[model samples]
Target: MPYPIVAAVVATMVLLGIYLSTAAPDLTFWDATELMAAAHTMGIPHPPGTPLWVLVGKLASMLFSSAAPPRAITLLSVWSAALTGGAAAYMAARWLGARGAVVAAVSAGTMLTVWNNATETEVYALSLLVSVLLLVTGEFAGRPDTDDHERRRARALMAFVCGLAVPLHLTVLVALPAAVAFAWRGPRPVWREVVAWVALAALGLSAIAVLPLFSAQNPTLDSGNPESWRALVSVLRREQYAVAGLWPRQAPLWLQLGNVFQWSDWQVAYGLHPFPTAHPVRTALTVLWAWLAVLGLRRLWRHDPRVGRAMLLLVLSASLGVALWLNMRAGPTFGVGLLPKGTPHEARERDYFFVLAFWGWGLLAGAGLSAIASALGRRLPAPVAMLPLALVVVPLLANRAVADRSREPVASLPRTYARLLLDAVPRRGVLFAGGDNDSFPLWYLQQVEDYRPDVTVITVPLLGAQWYRERLAAQQLLEVAAVARWPGQGAVLRSLVIHAEGARRAVRVSTLLERSDRLQLDPGGGWALQGLVYAPDRQLGAGQTGLDLPALRRQRSMVPMGALAPLPPGADPAAQTAQELLQCTQVLGPADSLLVSGCGGV
Candidate 1:
């Protein structure tokens, strides 16, 4: 069999085997649930909306829609990861040789981050695949052996892929510098070809139109209302997350550099056994990958300066350049970034953004290994030299325990909580869930499993956006009176709660947001339920003032969060719940035992 075919097979087996073994059995936390719900409903997701992924996931769901929607989407990610691994392997073989291809396959197949994402519903795998294809096709276009007509076509196609990538994930743009370098190193460009490329890119980007179309369809699962051109621009531009895309004001330069360094180290050492950054073995392995990448670039330059220059630029551009840019780009990370006071910021993990950089390094690592094989040929027997190559599998062994997440019950914990909350409410009651974790599971249960069709699930934070408000109004979930006070995009969502109360609408609040000041979930003014509150005044209320701890405890579905397992040390549980709520409170959960005064009264 051909080496590329062999590489593909090897990569697929590794990726599929591990991913299947550890895939999420159902919905996951964060965007996983949202994505699954969106795809299942053929609707738009959070911006910049991942329309292409939604389409692909929708197709995947067709095969198992009756039995399991979560599995379908999770499997889609697994398949995408496998494809990415295959493509990575093929690229390595084409660039280096058979041995290098094996190296690349193992590296990508065993990557912890890649494996972690493979078993869930997420966009990274697809993003990785598209990015790798761009690299491969872009390189093929630059090759001297290619014909002129083919080269032009390849360039145009590459541009189209670039445009497609734009709507998928912003991180893919990190490859732009490398793409430019590849073109510069390849054949001279024609103005017509460049123009064609630009036009094709625009044509490809028309996928963004999927948002408005899907939004107009009135799907059971909808996020942003992109039907209007203005809304479309906001969704596509990710204006909702603009603060995150902008650079941080308070972070020091050195801390940002440190964050990048640690992030880079984690990427390289991801799946290595004993792979903690502080561990000596993991540190050495990270250093080895780094050194190999450096050596590989040198080898590439020696072999073909043009190709070498492109690959080098790609590595730097994708890795260091992206790392620097991401570190500089700040938002509430949940707690990943370090503060000047030596404290961690919000806890959201940001390592996923650097996968492309690690991808480039993976290619370079293969080249480096190939170069090593060449050098060892003079001193050692070929078979004996090849024996050392087998050591690359060590990281796979190391990462197995960490990456095996297939046994995790999809949305089991959250689903349990969701069912509890839903059951506690009367039929046709409205439920307000604050953050991704608190809300998306409810969406999945509704859109995928068809749970509680009569009940309404409103994502509170999303209510701030005018597009979202308009969407709610169009769906009859909201009336004109609900949003009359808010006239702008991304406005306060307090009126949503107030409107529901004024209309005598029965509502249930997520424990994560029950005590929020924004929506005024108090006990008075027709908001009589102690388990849930509706503050007509929207004033600062005292702790447990109107909270019904006994009623909350008596509910069969209300499980005490404190009774749950301990959170990781130094990890703030509040930050996770903080996504929707505007302020922290002494009472943390629906039940009294779950209360934490550590939040300090707001």
Candidate 2:
């Protein structure tokens, strides 16, 4: 077989093997659960709906009928990432030969964020694949050997994929300029061809309509309930996250830039933080890595200036360009300096936003590595010469501890927490919960796993949305009374507890909600500490103020939070939970009492 074919196959097998070995075997936290829930049920998700992914994920679920819905749906990300790595390697080999292909495959495949996103059900992996495919198609189409007919067909496909990316994931747009600039370089298409391309593009754009059509059926997890044309427009525009302008940055531009560097530092060295958070050794390694990337760009410029310029546009537009556009809150500027705990205001690390940037670097790094290996080969014995090439294994070995999802119990831990909390609640109880880690997992278990459907789980912060309020009202879970928005959700939550009590339905609260001081769930408010959840206190207004259940408390250990990364301002939750809960609490079967499925009824 030709080198490109060999490269594609080898890269696919290597990356796919690595990904599956480390892949999340079941459900996950954050948007993973929500996205899986939406796709599995053919319902709506958060703003923009991700209709393209939902459709493709649904198809994967159907094809893999033997597997559980969560795992089957998650395969879309896993396979797409492997395919992306293969495609990337193929492109590198086509230009830079076999040595470059090996380096490219390793660099792209083992990127911390890329690897993490691939191991679970998420949009980024598939989105990256689509965008890369578009880039690859455009590059091949513009080749000198390519005929006019082939070029025209390729352009049409590129146009369609570009339009399709809108409903898939908007991050793909970061790649727009480079992909289009090259593909459209030929003689301008006449009005007739232009009209045809536009029509094809419009067809791809039409996929966004899937949201409204699906929402009209009233699916179980409709986020925006975008059944009408107006509602669809709101979701497509992402009204939740959109801002009028880029002024008044979320974090100081300087600090945010530092954050980008810090996260990039972690990409190669995960979980093994050197002393004092920002070790000199790490800074040295990061500088070396940046130099290699620059060297790779130099190689590209020398080898193929035309392609180099396009890929350069890709790197800048993807990395620095995206960072500027995000104006996002500060992340943990770990290596930057000693700043206040709250000084870095980002909720979660924003490294994933620059996925393409890192991916682009992988190609450059491959070129750089190949050049080094060649130089070493000319100066040393064959065995000694290949030593430098072993750096390809560095990422897998170094990043394994943190990026290996198979080892990370974050997936089952949330389900375990949900199991204990739901089991503790009475039948038909209304359970109020907290953030993505707390609430989304419960929804995944209840809706996707078909566990604890008898209990209703409401995310407190979402109560601020009128759509959510109306949805709950329609289900008779809550009434559309005057509401207090999130951060001050206390009043509305208190009213909910009282209303549920009046109806004689048991009301419970998740401890996760305690993260917000403005929300009240206390023994004084008739809530008794029951295991990981707070249950309605029957003895409210009586002499006893606090109540606890020993039987329920025993199950608390089952909730493992070992997957959470350490953030500043306090001791790490993972460490704290391990010491306080995992050490003393009664243990159970599997992984030395680190609950896999859950406490029970999973």
Candidate 3:
């Protein structure tokens, strides 16, 4: 096949793969939470991290229902990746010739990292797409013979695109050095034109920052008070500090530097341990891309001495620096010490590999493809020349198949749990959970069933004293006495106990499981109490007493079973009920205790 025809086919396959993969499932973490929150309110809040994406998601949801919004937004992400890939292909073809374009197109289209993000709601893919476009435009305008006016126009457009990407994700700012270099290589423009272009770019980018400012002015955009703006600013500053290696007591600089490449290994072994099969293709591609990157750098240094050498060096330094910064901010080495243990943030430090690997793979593959084509010209028949194309095409098809299987459409726990909780709870009561996990449940239930004003689902972590002081100011949840045990001895009548058996054993489960009771069976085949419970007269420790069978029978308003006999199957007389009472609550003896409950002002 002709090189252009081959590139077109490959690009089309990539786009189809991205669309199908994204359509298959909702794999992105925190996506539901951010979208739901945005749907209910106007301005962006803390946590969900990407304000721009959230705003866009909210708009999408408004146009369509929440159920359909995610898929629609995912489609947009797919298109963005395809467009970026095409731009990379064009740049390669223009710079290195037809063979280079074919290599670049295949490499970018088949890249696992880009494909992974294309099927999710994360902002990285969008940022990367914009970055590639800027680079391509810059490269095109940098030709020595390009007229000054044309160069000025091209530089201005590049600046504008970079500026638009800034608010979408602050990390895109890392590409500024490359952008500046691109512009400097071109013919000098009049000072006035440079100033004018800079201002236009700033204005376009500043459009994103304006949302927060507008929110500050209109407090009604969110539920919080005016002071919430200050909190938002503080959080943004902290994030910037963390990302820039300015966070205090961070890991040593050397370890942070090494973390970028090693991060993928850590993520697979530790982050997603039990689910090792989740992203096999992505893992393999990451390693392959890294190897090719090193090889590509060597080749650039040897043959393509000027522009290629500079590009290789710049990519390496920038990638290393960015990787170090992300590692410190994420603090993955501390294991589960951070808040929201096992969240995507803790695992995503490895995401930098996507961009780094794609560039490396493209450049190296371009060089290799060019060489092979040259060698085949004299020895191989024309028909056999298509074999090299097949080599690139097959892996891409396999990659797409793997990507499709790895994603699950209804895979989100938050959406499932939220729906379940909403159904279980009473219409006029509150349901409390441990952390930000509660946010999604609350937002979804309220939006889906209109349960907000009547039924509230409170998250304990967000209600803590420190959280209130920082985000809520003096208006904080009212804390009652810190009762030590459970069914709490207090007079609070109604409570829904949700015991997440799976979560209790994990590291850093305390914030969520701290005040809950733990029940277990003894080795001797009797019930065993594992935690304490509060009572009116005393703090009942575990295994302190047997269950009050007669009292429980009376509570049930029925006859009691005699002695310690087990309840007979299908003999459901109230007489057999008392024996099963102990099993219901998992009480070992009369003195066993239960969990407690209370509420606070906010």
Tell me each candidate's TM-score. Answer: 0.84, 0.87, 0.66
Per-residue alpha-carbon lDDT of candidate 1 for residues 549-589, written as tens digits (9 for 90 to 100): 44544552355443243323222233224311211122335
Candidate 1: where is the Cα deviation over 4 Å? 63-67, 183-186, 244-250, 268-277, 323-347, 408-411, 471-498, 523-593, 597-602
lDDT of 3 by residue, 1-602 (tens): 55544554555456656556544244233444444445445555443234566566556556545445445556556666776666666556544456556565656555555555666555666677777767766665765667777888888887787667645666565555655554566546779877887897887566555455545654322322223566455544544223444565255556555445444332212222222233565456445555544654455455434446546645654567565555453434433453364543342335444464444455555455554554565798956764554445433554554334223222343343344334333344444444444455456446534554454444443442233322322212222222222223121111212111122211111112233321111111211122111111113343232233433333223222222244222121221222332223333344333212211000
Better of 1 and 3 by lDDT: 1
Full-model lDDT, candidate 1? 0.64
Ranking by TM-score: 2, 1, 3
- lDDT string, candidate 2, 23-90, tens digits: 77786666888888888888888888999999998999898779878789788888999999888888
Model 1 poorest 10 in a row by lDDT: 578-587
TM-score of 2: 0.87
List candidate 2 segments past 4 Å from native: 242-244, 274-276, 332-344, 376-386, 408-411, 481-491, 515-526, 538-545, 551-602
Every candidate's lDDT: 0.64, 0.70, 0.46
Total clashes in model 2, counting residue pairs 3 or more apart in sequence or in different chains: 0
- By lDDT, rank the candidates, best first: 2, 1, 3
Pick out the ten consecutive residues of candidate 3 with the lowest summed lDDT: 502-511
